[model samples]
Target: MYRVMRLIRRFEERSIELVHSGHIVGGIHPYIGQEAIAAGVCAALRDDDIITSTHRGHGHVLAKGADPIRMLAELTGRSTGLNGGRGGSMHAADFGKGIYGANGIVGAGGAIATGAAWARRNDGSDVVTVSFFGDGAVNQGVLLETFNLAALWRLPVLFVCENNGYATTLTVAQAVAGSITARAEAFGIPSVSVDGTDARAVYAAAQAAAARGRAGMGPSFIECTAYRFDAHHTWEHKARVRYRSDDEVAAGRSRDPLDVLGLADEVRDRVDAEIEALLAEAVAFALDSPAPDPAGALDHLYATGLRTRDGNGLLDSAVR
Candidate 1:
């Protein structure tokens, strides 16, 4: 668990560097402090169990077994990306790994996960699905509707809320009117809150919830109270967002998740070396790879490989 958290932290830091250096075109939402939540939740899931991610989702994708090289390539808009460089940061996906995709919508993934789990259930399989979202999603009507449907139909969906206290610059206290757990309880779904800084605690809670789902006990909700060690997005590094005070950030950083591991110096050194080597290779691959061609931009726009016509009812220039 600690290793996974460490990997996510290092990966997020490197991504931020790429964003600053113009290597990665658009800025990213760094999942620095919330690594424990993703690491823990994914640790308790099966390879076949599906999960949907949020905009700040690199950690979740990595924990779910995405190749670092391909993921990095995707962020850099390389043709060798997992989504052929189309999905980029907020939408990278690996369906082969049971990842639906990291959506940019606040609560859209919850609906997608619920639907996916329902489809799997209809097919006579005990496949479980997890929906990961931030605190901002609690107020989303679609998410609440998903919660209702999930409970009503005994769907195998686990809703994991990474409540890092803020929805962008809006604090949870400022936005959420009622208790986060109570929202799930109102839908007749069992819910709990766990320490978002402890990977083991989150894993145990998620494991129990997944067991209930597999046993046909319907959906479950877990609210992870974590803190974002960095800005909400890499762009904030240059912006003047004063939502959080320096002291508050210091307090949050004090509770380092790596402290839980207490790994020996030699062991830590070895892990660091391995991660550095792997990231170095991934960076090289992303830099060497070419961007997707504009002519093929609309190649796979539709599921049936259908082509669209221009205003003249002829094939688009790209397709032509």
Candidate 2:
């Protein structure tokens, strides 16, 4: 678990550098301070289980066993990307590994995951699914609706909310009325709130939830209270949003998740060094990867090997 947390930390740091260097266009929502939640929840899932993620989701994808090189390629929009360069940073997906997708829409993954779990159960598979979302998603109607369905059908889905204090510029207090857990409770879904900064606590909570879901118990929800130590988006470097005070930022940085892992200084240093090396290799692979050709943009839009008409309105007989 410690190693996985370290991997996510280094991956985010390297990804931030890539964004600044213009290697990753459209920028990214850095998961710098929220590594613990991804690491912990993924640790509790079986390899065959599924997960859906949000815009701030690179950490979740990485923690779920996505290859770093391919993830970096995806962010760089290379042909070797997880989505074949079609879905960049906010839309990477590795269905082979049970990662449904990293959705750009906030809170939409919950319903998608619920449906996936329901389908799997109907197919006689006991694979559970997890949906990772931000605090802002708590207000989304689809998420609430999915909660009701999951509870009613007793679907094997886990909802993990990474409550990082603010949703873009909006604070949780301003955006969310009433409590997050209470919403889950309304549907009779057992929910728990834990410190998002503590990786172990999240792992324990997720483990228990996964156990219950696998045992045919209904869905579960976890509200992980955490703080983002960086800007909400890389564009903040130019936009300069002043929603948070300097003191608050300083205080949040004080509780670094890496430091809280409780490993000895020597062990932590070794782990950091190893992760740095791995990130360097990942970046090199991403840089050397080929970009997808524009002519083949719709290659994987369909799974049946069928091709759609080109946007230029050229019929099969027009060229001949």
Candidate 3:
């Protein structure tokens, strides 16, 4: 678990550098301080189980065993991306590894995961599904509807909410009207709140939730209270948003997740060295990969392989 968090931490740091260097276009929702939630929740899930993620989801994907090289490529919009360069950062996915996708919509992944859980239950597969969302997502109607359905149908879905104190520039207290746990309780779904900064606490809570789900106890919700040590998006570097105070940012940074895991100094040093080596290879792989051709832009638009005529009524030239 310590190693997992360490990897995610380094990955986020490197990704931020890529964003600034123009390697990753369209910027990214940095998950710099919320690595523990993903690492802990994924550690509790089986390899065959499924998970849906949110905009700040690179950490979740990496934690769920996604190849860092492919993830970085996806962020870079290279053909080597998980979606073949179509989905990019907010939509990277590998269904073969049970990662549905990192949805751009605030609360959309809840329903998707619920549907997957329902299908898996009907198929008689014990594979459970997990959904990771931000605190702001609790107010979304889709998530509330999903909670009701998952509870009513007794689906094995675990909803993990990373309540990192802010939703973009809005604070949780300012945006959320009712208690998060109350929302789940309204639909008869069991729920709990845990320390989002502590990886062990999250891991234990998620483990119990997954256990109950597999035992046919229906879905569970966990609200993790955490704080982001970095800006919400790379654009902040240019726009200079002042929603958070300098003191607040300093305090948040002090509670580093990597330090909370209590990894031995020797272990930490070794992990850092290994991750540096891994990232060097990932960067090379992403840069050397060929970009997708314009003519094949819609290659995977549909599962049936049906092609639509271009708006100009002519085949678009292939990308050189």
**lDDT per model vs. reference:** 0.92, 0.90, 0.90
| Tens-place lDDT digits, model 3, residues 104-198 | 99999999999999999999988889999999999999999999899999999999999989999999889988888888989998899998889
Q: Put down candidate 1 lDDT per residue, 1-320, tens digits, no spaces.
A: 77677788888888888999999987999999888899999999999999999999999999998998999999999999999999999999999999999999999999999999999999999989999999999999999999999999999999999999999999999999889999999999999999998888999999999999999999999999989999998888888688899999999998876775577888888888888888889889999999999878777877867668766779877667
Which regions of candidate 2 deviate over 4 angstroms? Answer: 310-312, 315-320
TM-score of each: 0.96, 0.96, 0.96
Candidate RMSDs in order? 2.1, 2.1, 3.1
Clashing pairs in 3: none
Candidate 2 global CA lDDT score: 0.90
Q: What is the lDDT of residue 187 in candidate 2?
A: 93
Candidate 3 has an lDDT of 0.90
Clashing pairs in 2: none
Q: Which regions in candidate 3 have their CA more than 4 angstroms from the true location?
A: 310-320
The TM-score, computed over Cα atoms with residue i paired to residue i, of candidate 3 is 0.96
